[model samples]
Target: MTSALILENLCKSFGSGADAVQVLDHVALDLPQGQSLALTGDSGSGKSTLLHICAGLEPFDRGKVVLAGHDITQNDDAAGAALRRDTIGLVFQQFNLIPSLTVAANLAFQARLAGRHDPDFTTELARRLGIAQLMSRYPEQLSGGQQQRVAIGRCLAARPRLVLADEPTGNLDEATGDAVLDLMMELAAQAGTALLLVTHSTRLAQRCDSRVHLRAGKLQVPA
Candidate 1:
């Protein structure tokens, strides 16, 4: 089967010379379509860096990153941005919703940007995420969990082939987090989107189809 995301011998560094920080060192991973994998690691363990690279939000110093048959690792800014807008969805821990936009509008933002807006699908996602009632409100008016639901809805609105989530539930309470994650997983499965989620919760990691741990800037399958 073709991989939805493939990273081969990935390496990334920040800054220069003595001040440079190496976040990923020859890391490699492959995630097939419709599968979900949890990436777990301590703070600054390169988990978020890996997600950024895979999502085309950041560039890797070396190695290849292929998403849905497109080699995005070496693309120029415009090309990479286009690929990301068309093929990748990202959910961050900060719930990066536009503060001024209404919930419904925020959910539809990316889809509209990608020229793939589908009101019907956005409505369904809102309903499934239990955020239909909050659609008229702005991000500040909603609770953390509600904001997260909106974020997830926004990512799913485009029905992109790959979803990259970074600490998606880190700010929510246990019950709310579990409920939101359940909905996310269900929707991701239904959409057949490959999910790469960076998380710290072992229970959450165990619930995914596979789990990978980042240590010393390399990925290892958990035993």
Candidate 2:
């Protein structure tokens, strides 16, 4: 199967010289299309940094990053933005929904930005996420779980080739988080989007097709 995301010899650090802190060291990974992979590590383990690099939201000191078959290691700001607009979906733990927009509008925002707005698909996603009736509600009016459902709906609305999620369910209780994750994985599979999820839950990580652990700024065998 073709890979949707690849990282080779990736290196990243903060600051410079003596005060510099290495975050990623020669990290390598290959995530095949239409599959899911869980990335697990302790706090400060660089898991979120890795996801950001993959999404072109951050830069690495040295390495190669390819998303949906396009090399992004040397991409300029505009190029990186274009790559994200065209091929990547991001879901954050904070449920980054636009407070000014109603749930329906928020759900279609990313798709509209990507020029892939599909009313039929958006409606179906809302129905499946159990947020169809909340379409007219604003982000601030929804509960944490509801807001997250909208966030997931918005990300997948763009039909992106790859989805990067950073602790998407961290705000919810265990049962709610599990349910949200189940919905996310199910929808991602239906869309055939490659998913790289950064999470701390062992049970959640085990639900994915494969798992990778990060330690000491390098990829380690999954524990």
Candidate 3:
């Protein structure tokens, strides 16, 4: 089967020769459709950098990144933005909801941008996330957990081929985090969206289809 996301011999660094710090060295990954892969590492281990590369938000020095059969490494910023707008969903720890837009509007924002807006799907998704009641309220009106639920909803609104979550539950307490994870997994699976999750929580990592640990810019199977 075709992989949902792939990275082969990926390399990345910051700065020029003298001050350059190699962040990723020959990293590789293959995430299949409807599967979740957890990325774990210590601070400054390049997990976020790797996620950004996969998202096509950051360019790498060498190697390949393919998403849903397209070579994201080859895309220019405009193309990358288009790809990200259409094919990928992102969930961040901070729950980057628009304070200005109402919950309903925020949820539909990206879907609209992708030209795939579906009011029916958005309504159903909100209902599924248990945020249907808050549709009229602004993000600031919700709790952190509620904001996160909205963020997750927004990610799924476009029915993206892949979902990249960067410590999605980091801002929540253990119980809330677990709850959010359950909902995220359930919803992503229901939509057949592949998941690439970056997290420091071993429990969260263990919940994915597989776990890969990062250290000093390299990847290893959890021993």
Candidate 4:
């Protein structure tokens, strides 16, 4: 299977020289299309940093990052932005929905940005995510779970080759989080989009196709 994301000998740090703090060290990962991998680590372990680098939102000190066949390292700012818009989807714990837009518009936001907007597909996603009835509602008008379902629908509506989610279920109750994850994974599978998820929940991690724990900026099998 082709890989949607690839990282090789990745390294990142803050500051410089003796004052520098290494957040990621020789970190490497590969996520194939249509599969899911969970990333687990303690706070400040650089899991989110890794996801940002893969999305071309952040730069690595030394490494190669390829997203859906494009080597992002070689892309300039505008090129990287375009590549990210076209090939990557992002979901965050905060449910970054545009408050000004209704649920229907929010769901179609990313897709429209990528020029992949399909009215039929967007409507299908809204129905599948159980947010069809909430489309006319604004983000603030919906509950946490409802907003998150809209967020997920927005991410997948772009038909991105990969989805990089950082602690995507952190704000919801356990049951709600689980249900949200179930919908996320199901939707990802249906769209054939690879998923790389960051979470601290062992139960949630186990639900993915594979799990890797980040320790001291390196990945290892979960103990």
Residue-pair clashes per prediction, in order, are 0, 0, 0, 0
lDDT tens readout by residue for model 1, 1-223: 7699998999998899999988899988889999999999989898888888888887779999999999885588898888989999999887889998999999999999999899999998898778899989999999887898899889989988899999888877888789888977887899898999899999999999999999888888899
Top candidate on lDDT is 2
Of the two candidates 1 and 2, the one with more favorable TM-score, higher being better, is 2
Strongest candidate by TM-score: 2
- Measured on C-alpha atoms, candidate 2 has an lDDT of 0.90
| Clashing residue pairs for model 4 | none
Badly placed stretches (over 4 Å) of model 1 are none
Q: How accurate is candidate 1 locally (lDDT)?
A: 0.89
Between candidates 2 and 3, name the one with more favorable TM-score: 2
lDDT, candidate 3, at 64:
94
Q: Write the per-residue lDDT of candidate 4 for residues 168-217, one digit (tens) a residue.
A: 87867888678778878987899888999999889899999999999998
**TM-score of model 1 (CA atoms):** 0.94
* lDDT: worst 10-residue window of model 3: 171-180
